[model samples]
Target: MKLLVLMSLVYLLGSTEALKVLVLFPYAVKSLSILGTGAVRHLLNAGHEVTYITVYPLKDPPTKNFRQIDISKNAELFKNDDSLTIGYVLEHQVQRTDPLQIQLVTQESARLTFENENVKKLIEDPNEHFDVVIVDLVETETFAGLAVLYDCPMIWLYSMGAHWQPLRLIDRATNPAYDPDYLSPAKNPLSFLERVDELWTRIKWQYRKTFIIQPEERKIYEDTFGPLLEKRGRTLPDYEEVIFNASLIFGNEHDAVRDRPSTPQNFKFIGGLHVEEPVKPLPKEFQDLIDNSKHGVIYFSMGSFLQSNSLPKPLVAELLRMFGGLKQTVIWKFETDLPDVPKNVHIVHWAPQQSILAHPNVRTFITHGGLLSSIEAVHFGMPIIGVPVFFDQFTNIKKAVENGYALTVPLSHNLPKDLKAAIDVMLKDDTYRKKAKELSSIYHDRLTKPGVKFTHWVEHVVRTRGARHLRSPAWRVPLYQRLYLDLIALVLASVYLFFYIVSRLFKKTPKKTDKKKRN
Candidate 1:
């Protein structure tokens, strides 16, 4: 009888711990979607039932508790927009350093996601309920409508290092003085001009968000979620307030990769959550190439979004010429076949990037400096030569350069010479290699794997019913108070009043001040 009672208790505890999670990652970007899927997979591993809304679906065998709502049709929106492509940006000489531009794109993506037939059905169904909602935090405020509809705690999964935008929602915004904007190329310990530029960039972004993006997002939010709230006899909350209602933020950052910034208890760092553990062995072809390399090997890739085939012919020729002279074998991730390839250079249409980086025979990485690529390089103890294209790529590269394990070559007229120089320096110098190894050691020294930590915190939030106690008090403070602007204004007013009193008293005794002149 006692044994039966114990078994029954265990079953009850297990059943109670299992949560119903709703994950919405409607963005079409593969890299961004990967982060969301990582969290979803972890949640599933922890025995939670997940309803995943994504443009990319996991290929794993179907699980009993996992249900995916495909929004792959959203990818068509990106297919029609070429402005974000590296080829278009390069040919048009477009600078994608504006945060507002990226936000605008995200806003549009959120609108389309709501309009998705499956997504509309899910939100419209009153039966659709979840214990918690996890959404991608890439300027995706409109998705918060689901959280409101379900009346569940929302968690933001930030795909990059701590940025001011998302931080402001959960806690105080990071200072622009030391922390550069993610879109800016400026590094930490910023120069005077860089600080000025950073502040101006932030101001512009805030202005645009308040005036342009938020208004449009509010309309979309009300149109989608307003009816649901009305049916429940609940009035819609302020859009700004709804977006700020998240209980926790999971940022993809690690102190080993970047300097640790001040974060609230509610904000968790779970960088490298997507990195596979005990990395899979390389395919035989790649293994043989790495093993047979005479001196060493250099791996080159422009990430998923930027295709190497889009590079100009002259630049391609220049890269080929440079690779031909090098004793080190070059493995380039190109999308299409190129004519007159060098004997030393091998081209693969697709690459197992992490697998290649893990190889000891690979010396240096030539990359477009996406955050994931940079973190992978540091994780594998491999030095990199960054050729940043757009968005946070420049900032990621700048951070890498400052960290001593990477060098950057601009995509300009001097790119050929600069690329060759960077590669040669990275190959010949052992300092870069040493620094990379040091960082890798730090990255691997964590007590718990990022995936496990991510799962624990997420479960903690659900178990604690939003963990509201972990939230920062700064969120309750007004912006003016947080900035100490109100204090500054009071002090200024006091000084002005003191001066005014002193001036009036002096005027009453004015005759004494000019005594010498009167005599």
Candidate 2:
């Protein structure tokens, strides 16, 4: 009888502590989905019941607590989309600062996610319930409706560094005077013109988001989630309210590698959480190649999204010619084979990037400036030469340059020469390596591993029932009040009224004097 009571008590406690978490990362970008995967894995390992909605599902067999809703079909949209390729972007001179194009693209992706048969089935299931909903912090605002439907706390996962878009959702907007927009090419300590440009860029984005993007997203939100709400006899809340009601935001950022902004309590930085520890060993061939390098090795990759084969033929030839002349071994992540390859250069269709970076013989990394790559380079104490393609890549590289561990070479006719020059500097300069190591030390100096911290906060939010106390008061404050625009208008109006009164008094005094002279 005593044994039966003890066993029952243990089972009840375990059941009470295990939360049902729904993680939605329906974005087709593999790089972005990796962050979501890291968070989900941690949740699963923590004994939580997780139902992950992903474009890339885990290859391993599922456990009892883990359920995957694969939406890999959505990734087909990007597989053949040349416009998203770096070559197309460079050739067409796409203005990444303009949010219209990307906003539309992400909205389309959200629509696809909502329409996914698996996602729909999950939504329609009457018995489905979640204690918390974790979602990607891109333009997937419509997915926030799930939290509303399930009546669970929503946690946003940001795959990039802290930016105004996600920040404004949980806290106040960042100052544009010094903090450049994520998509803007401008760097900090901006010149007068740069400041004006930054301010205008933000204003334009906000205007477009308010007048254009929001309405479209609202419609999509309603169209997708309306029936579910109707079935429950509940009307949908305002789109903005639903999206902004997130309990917390976990940003892939660290002060050691990137600038730390004034973030609220609800905002947490868990950069490098995706970097698996005890990195897998390199293949024997790669290991031997790195170990036998005379001078050192330069590892070059354009990340998962951009393909090296997409580069213009002339540029590819130029890169090859540059690599041939270099004394250091060059390992390039190229998608397709090239003719007349250099003996010193090695090409791999796919690479174990972290393993390669962890090798001591790797002197420098030539990269696409993706946040993950940048953070990984910092993690392994490798200096970088960034060739930023678009979007936040530019910002990530700019921050690295400002931090003294990296240099940027723009994509153009002079890229080969400029890249060679930067490579030469990175190889010869001990200062860059020293700075990288220093940043690495700081990055590793955290009290807890990022994954542990991430899981703890997530469980904390669940335990505390959304941890509402950590939410910023700024979310409750009106936009006009937050900006103090009303106060400024009141002061300006008072000054204008005072000046008008004085002008009238002077005119009346002059009229009286003229009348007295006539008398």
Alpha carbon lDDT of each predicted model: 0.85, 0.87
Candidate 2: where is the Cα deviation over 4 Å?
1-16, 95-97, 483-519
lDDT by residue (tens digit), candidate 1, 124-219: 787889999999888758888888888888999888888788888888888899877777767777789989988988888888888888899999
Model 2: lDDT to the true structure: 0.87
RMSD of 2: 4.4
TM-score of each: 0.90, 0.90
* Worst window of 10 by summed lDDT in candidate 1: 510-519
lDDT of 2 by residue, 283-362 (tens): 99999999999999999999988888888899889989999999999999999988989999998999999999999999
Candidate 2 residue-pair clash tally: 0
- Candidate 2: 10-residue stretch with minimal lDDT: 510-519
